[model samples]
Target: MLHLRAICPAERTDAVLAALKAEPGVTHVVLLRGAAVDPVGDVVEADVAREATDQVVASLCDLGVDRDGGVTLEQIDTALSDAADRAEEAAPGDGADAVVWEELLARTGEESRLNATFLSFLTIACLLTAVAVVTDSPVTLVGAMVVGPEFGPLAAISVGLVLRRWDLVRRAALALAAGFPVAMLITAVGTWLGSRTGLFDPDLALAGHELDFVFEVGPFSLIVALLAGAAGMLSMTSAKSAALVGVFISVTTVPAAGYAAVAAVLGQWDICLQSIAQLAVNLVGVVVAAALVLALRNRRGQVRDLGRPLGNG
Candidate 1:
């Protein structure tokens, strides 16, 4: 279930109430007339079935509630009312299977932003991967992959492609294009610093590291990339946080970047080129696969919506 809070203009309060009453999946409607001081409107609140979120939200938007007022939805983790159960039963489809597109758009938009935290995660992940390569440990490599925030922009890019939101695509592309280079630069500097200590020897590490096989760009790597991308997209659409961690390990995104950084620092141009190629392949694989998955999901949603009566789903 979800809790919806809306600020509706005084004149539109009746329309808002009518819309809520019309939705079979909506219940426990609470209205406070002229109670929104900042917006100078009526405060309307309701509990809605999760499956009906998209439609309910769309209806509110159509009423222009978002233009002059505000509409916000928050998940109701625990709805103790028997009315909530009745509302859930009235809604079509399972709640978990529903996709709230506006919510996704808002979330991906935030995730795609290249902020300080994003940069820090990417840089730290790359540094960890570099350490994994030097230490020849697969565990550390997986750690690095899990810590990487590159998936945010990748998911954003996929969403943009599916929705044909070129602005979103451009923003995500810019984030990825800028973020990787910065992370690689950090990785390189970190490697150089580590080399200053007797504990690090790039040449020796390169000769026997397990990651050499990981960096090898080949058909198998592409296969893994495709699978990882598909899984990652599914995880995002389903809101499966645990599944995302597996995706982190499945794709070679951060590991490839880390390997390239270490190779560059060690002046192994050939290895660096291979790792770069590996990175490119993985990125393309994940992005393209995710886009396809989202496109298919969108089509299915459209078909289902078409099958339903107007204003009912």
Candidate 2:
């Protein structure tokens, strides 16, 4: 279940209440008049089912209260009243059980873009990954994966496709297409400097090292990417953000890019190409899997919305 908060003038309270009461899954409504001090007005709270949240929000939006007033929805963990219990019962089971494409898209729409702080982290992570690849340190590679911010754009792309939001798709693609090339160029310069300073030796490569797992692309990599993509989407839609960290570690985009940078420094075109190929394979697998999942989820939602009487019409 979800709790919706709305603030509007006391005069407008009746209209807003009527609209909220008419919503499909709204189980409880509370009105507190002229309660706030700063920009004081009335507060209307509604308890609604999770599956019906999107429609309820849409209805409120159509009423123009979202602009004239403020509206917010938060997931409710426990219910203290009968209305709340009904709302809970109306909720879809275990938000993680299946993807809800429209809900996912709506949730993603709320995500903020990569700001300066995030970009700075990405820079530091890329540099560390580059250094790790040159030194062949598995520990540093993992650290880089933990620090990288590339997953946001990738997730945005998947959500964009599901929502059919071309602007989002273009923005995400631009971020990914531009981000890696810039990171690679910067890493290449760093590697060249390190080679001259004896901190890195181009003659020494980790191709024979047991930890050299960057270039071996196979079915396992595809499976990992697919699973990671699904998990990532689930994390985005649900409240389980901690799981996204694990998803990041499972994917190989950052490590592969780091490997490619090191291969470029060593002047090993073959290894560089191989690393690039591995990254490509993982990326393609994740995007394709995410798109398919979204498509299936959207189809199911449409059927459910139509209320087709559960059997042959």
Candidate 3:
């Protein structure tokens, strides 16, 4: 369920109330009038079901509430009201079952653009990976992977596919295609310079390393990426950004990129190709897994909508 706070002039309160009353899944309407010192209007507070939030918000907007004063709706993440609990008791599935493709797309935010934070994250990931390779530490390599912020855009691409947002899809694809190569190139140059300074010795290259954990692509890596992608999507949709740290560690993208750079610096062409392949496999696995999760969740949402006459459509 969602809680909405709408501020409008007292005179227009009737229109706003009328609009809210007409909308489905809107209940517990409370009006607090003449609260503002500037006396712009009254404030209307209400609880709305998650399924009906979009329509209710749209209805409020149509009533010119936004222009006259303003309407703000925030999702209530706490315990539900008695009425909502009763409704949920009557319903089989939780609100998450009603997460439609559109809702997911909205949660995805602006995928058509790359923000500074994302770019900075990529840069840091690349830099960290270079440092890890030069130091020949698997721990540092994993640290670099966990620090990378490329997963958001990757998840955005999957959300785009499930929602059929071609703009999102194209932007995500472009970001991935462009971002990885650029990062790899930068890491490669950094690795080369590190080699020249005797910071990274050719003997420590991962190419002929016997450790099964260091340079091999296996089922374990695929599983890790799949899990990481799922967790990433959950974190993104819930807006719990802190979980991304664990996700970065769960995937091998940064480690593989680092390995590729290290191989390039040592002039090990075969190992470089193998590392690149590992990175590609992990990327594909994460995206595909995320897409499948979104698709299934969307299908469940459709089913729930069919069962309820909430006028959400």
**Best of the candidates, TM-score:** 1
Q: What lDDT tens digits, residue by residue, belong to model 3 across residues 169-253?
A: 7777777777777777887887778778877676765533332253577888788788888877766555365887888787878
lDDT of 1 at 176: 87
Each prediction's total of clashing residue pairs, residues at least 3 apart in sequence or on different chains, is: 0, 0, 2
lDDT (Cα, 0-100) at 47 in candidate 2 = 83
> Cα miss at 108, model 1 (Å)?
0.5
Instruction: TM-score winner between 1 and 2, please give it.
Output: 1
Compared with the true structure, the alpha-carbon lDDT of candidate 3 equals 0.69
Task: List candidate 3 segments past 4 Å from native.
Answer: 5-44, 49-92, 96-103, 207-215, 235-244, 300-313
lDDT of 1 by residue, 165-273 (tens): 7777777788889999999998898899888876687568788656777679999988888888888888776646579889988888888998999999899889899
lDDT digits (tens) for residues 15-34 of candidate 2? 88888777656777888988
Winning candidate number (lDDT):
1
Q: Is candidate 1 or candidate 3 better by TM-score?
A: 1
Q: How do all the candidates rank in terms of lDDT, highest first?
A: 1, 2, 3
TM-score comparison, 2 vs 3, better candidate: 2
Q: Could you arrange the candidates by TM-score from highest to lowest? A: 1, 2, 3
Model 2, runs deviating above 4 Å? 8-12, 22-28, 34-41, 75-83, 92-114, 300-313
